[model samples]
Target: MKHLFSVLCISAGSILSLSAQQTQKPILYGRNWMAITGKPLAATAGAMTFQKGGNAVDAACAMLAATCTMWDTLSWGGETQALIYNPKTKKVIAINAMGVAPTGATIEFFKSKGYNFPPEYGPLAATTPGTPGGLIYMLVNYGKLSLKQVLEPAMKMAAGYPIEAQAANSIEKGKEHINQWPYSKKVFLTHPGEKREAPEAGEIFVQKDLLATLTKMVEAESKALKQGKTRKEALMAAYDRFYKGDIAKEFVRGAQEQGGLITMKDLANWKPLQEEPLQVNYKGIDVFKLQQWTQGPVMLQALNILENFDLKGMGYNSPKYIHTLYQAMNLSFADRDFYYGDPTTMPKGPIQGLLSKDYAKERAKLIQYDKNNTNIGPGNPYPFEGKTNPYLNLLQQRGYEMDTTKRNFAPKHDLGKINTSSDDVYQERLLLGTTSIEAADKEGWVVSVTPSGGWLPACIAGETGIGMSQRMQSFVLDSALNPFNVLAPGKRPRVTLSPSMALKDGKPFLASAVQGGDTQDQNLLQFFLNVTEFGMNVQQATEAANINTNQLWLSLGGTKTEDRMPKPGQILLNNNTPSATREALQEMGYILSFGARTSGPINAIYFDWKHGSLWGGSSNHGEDYGIGW
Candidate 1:
């Protein structure tokens, strides 16, 4: 494996000045290809694929597979979402690899069981695994390599890889849950019996069960090829082995034993959707994301609202700038909470109205420049369609009342004197257990993907080494009022796994993604603005201080009584942000919480139009790494 600091340094006489390196965040520069991922090993896997003549899609799949093994918070059985930009077609494709509820899942099912909402963990929360199917789909349709070839690296890592400190910490946090399930304990703990604990960082952690499972699929593919099946046919056979063959049987048996609802039919019928990407034009640059099912559209709506402001004049991370950004996010998130859902169940209004420039102009008027507004709510988007949201009253009734005083905003990290002892002043660093990868080849093909689920608190299938996803928890149980995200069989719960792509002058310009659940789109928007509006390179943009609003509806299941509103005058800022700016914001009536960390580790690759080279950047805040050659 390649070292994290290893880079193919370009010669001194390049378009970019070498002197600037000392001042700016380090960025990996390469003439042919680049891969930025959540882990150095994963990036190295992708780079190896690229070196072996694979395209960007192939490299991305390889990297994602390796990431699933190395990142304890991610699993092969989790959900995967991606956006692929093919320069040859001048188009971007959205891959909705998120899983849906089983046929047995329904509001009444949970109601009869005396549950208000779906469980946050265990087999009951599991949806059909989509990552495997999604990976196979990408490989068969767009990749230049076989499934066996791409999965080899992942199998090797799963057998025994050097554990990192973060992964060990995550394992420790979920130790109790893993201990309850024998399969999970066997795979994640240093010992399955008493004295079990998270392995030490740099210790060789072996996942023999996971390796056996992956090897089985590879063998299945090889058997199909030996039987005279075509490459695509062999790939499909291997995919079926996970969803419709022995793996599916094991999942069904485990769920049945554990009182869960998933069945073989659900797995057999599941298929990842390939759809047109939702897009909005910003300053002549086209930004694309997944559909309304995700919080992706919130970023677009916020961008539309922000376009009306001269953000550059406000200064980056300045009080006014941050305020404006948060306000836009608040409005968009308000709308998202009230309306965003699966396309099949979305309200009557066309989604286009939400993205329209005209609607953005109207919504922009809600921004109050002189003071912060805490009582902001979703606008009348239906008015544009000559209708009203009939369920608005029910939404308001169910909404958690805004109580800023009760909201918590303390730093989770113990940053010496900056840390506070007050419970309300402290906040937990939210880890959603997700990973992202970006790959770009010399051919101009770019791929960005976010894979999640089956992390800590996940239920491992019986002897399969597959951790089931808890994505079903994203759905609301209200059958009457929660029309969009209401629990239903065959319905995909609204998710936060958003991957993004951007184009400039009809050419591929950017591919980026982050792993911060509800904060994914919010942080991604900041990165985009840092580059487009502030003229920062990939590295500088990634390393910049980021802010997240708690005012939006919580995506994960948590205490129902907690206030779901953004604390009035309260925003989170990393300690790296200037103290002067923090004081200014505090004086402006904005409560500030300082932490030593950013919202997420955003991995991205930028296509330098002038230089015709790829510049890649990854966050140093986490295990992220960037490699190019």
Candidate 2:
């Protein structure tokens, strides 16, 4: 009887494992791709478009439109940086819709206002919004479906849709912010006398104004078409409705009343800056990225640095793996702070010399296996700078260096000084001890991004709930010498948004971006390492144990990380991390602090031409969902 019971138990275990495997369902379709976002409805919308015979670009358009109404963190009012891989042309094109400083913005004007860069320099700090322009560009250049058709899903959702877990959470958390703006509050809040009546987990919230805005856009497009205007011309007319017509006027009035500096000219004169995407060749794969304004180069530098070592040998999620990745991130961030900026405005090559292949190789040589305290600034590899290919360097070179100089890793100051109290040496030792790290598997797609402009106080005031751009908050106020980065008009703030893409066998595979302030790169790096090096599926890759070492300390989250998280410094390890690995890290003199770290939600679409599939992944930490059919 005992023997029979043991056999039955083993059989049951086998059946359970098989069930788990089967539950890991695959989204399959012909002439159909799959996409996953943080929102199920949004994913369904994209899938519906795919089912309607729209290609990737069309699906992208439809999904984005829906997201504008469905997700508050993303909207038509925001900006976008995208990379579209067109197999037909055998080329990858990038679109940077990142806004620019208004024409009237100037350092001198800001100085005269008796304000240093305070993270909220009013309208003078607001850049010309480029999202609408960028979408228009995508529709004009890449979209096959008419603008009307592409916007249908978003319009439908905007008209009315049930709020799901993600949307409800956003509403609940952003209550203060939503209530602050009359229009915003109207769209999100339940009704009069119901200040806290947020939608339940599966209730409904409607954005009537957004729906109305969409209606106006559709009408504007119709009017333009009747006048025999081109599609681009029609879109431009719609843009004017928001920027030059009543919307623009209202926004301007609000800014003026609120002591903000936005003007009608700022909106009317706004244009998307056309530039080339930066590219790098890593291990026979061509990686492409947006320029400095988004911090895309740092990833290229880090990957290049990693290429020098055999990461596979280090073992997945081991102390060695985490150590190497953190070191690479720290080094790349150092370069990001010091030399990265709008290249066009800077001399022909500010850090062009630093991002070269030779420089990356040289930087990679500095990775010490055992030593901690190994800090090096960026190196200028002048001779290896590549040709400028649609790359727009959008940072002010004069003040750019100042921001970099004051960065926490700039040799003198201790990163721990700002937040964690552990000494630098102690932190390094602690890092060496923590283990059980796993890399995301490279399923069918890859994402690389460099989203920038987070310098001072997150400016968000006036103009239909428009807040000041987060770029203004990049500075730390009381610096005795070289005290800049205080939110100032015309002063472009520091940014960490890096536009990114991955390639396999010299072909473009994935293009993506995320919105974490500083942790974007860390997230992307981990994902990239997981997929390409560790070989995990997309979901597992995204869900794997991940640690974010933004500066000196590390925070864990995700499938693997979350389990052991909430474990404080010196807390017991109740995780699958190998005892050997933990011992190794502890031996390195590290103190473990288990908690959640924010690495803004990541977004990307992958093209697996060989398999005739395209896959996309969105951030688990965000309200966005991944949908692909």
Give the winner by TM-score.
1
Global fold similarity of model 2 (TM-score):
0.76
lDDT of 1 by residue, 1-629 (tens): 02111111112232243224342348899888898888888999998888888999999999989988875667877898899987678789988888889978888887787666677788878888889999999998889898888988898888898988888878877888878777777777885454638787888988877888898889889999999999999999989888888878887887667777888999999998898889999999999999988888998999999999988766667666887898898778767866778885445334677888887888788776645566565565666665665765664454423232342332111111322222242244233548889999889889999888887756788878788888887887764324578888888888888888999999988889997767888889999998898777888777777897665556765423132223444577887765655655555556667666664688899888898999988876778887898
> What's the lDDT for residue 320 in model 1?
67
Candidate 1 wrongly placed segments (more than 4 Å): 1-25, 112-114, 192-196, 345-350, 385-388, 395-431, 479-482, 559-568, 576-580
lDDT of 2 by residue, 389-477 (tens): 22222222211222333533333432233323434433322221100000011222222222222111122333343333433333322
**Please, what is the whole-model Cα lDDT of each candidate in the order they appear?**
0.77, 0.52
Could you tell me which 10 consecutive residues in candidate 1 have the lowest summed lDDT? 1-10
Which structure among the candidates has the greatest lDDT?
1
Tell me the lDDT of candidate 2: 0.52
Question: Which regions of candidate 2 deviate over 4 angstroms?
Answer: 1-31, 103-126, 191-197, 347-349, 380-410, 413-471, 474-494, 512-515, 552-576, 589-591, 596-610, 615-624
Model 1 lDDT, residue 507, Cα: 90
Candidate 1 lDDT at 526 equals 97
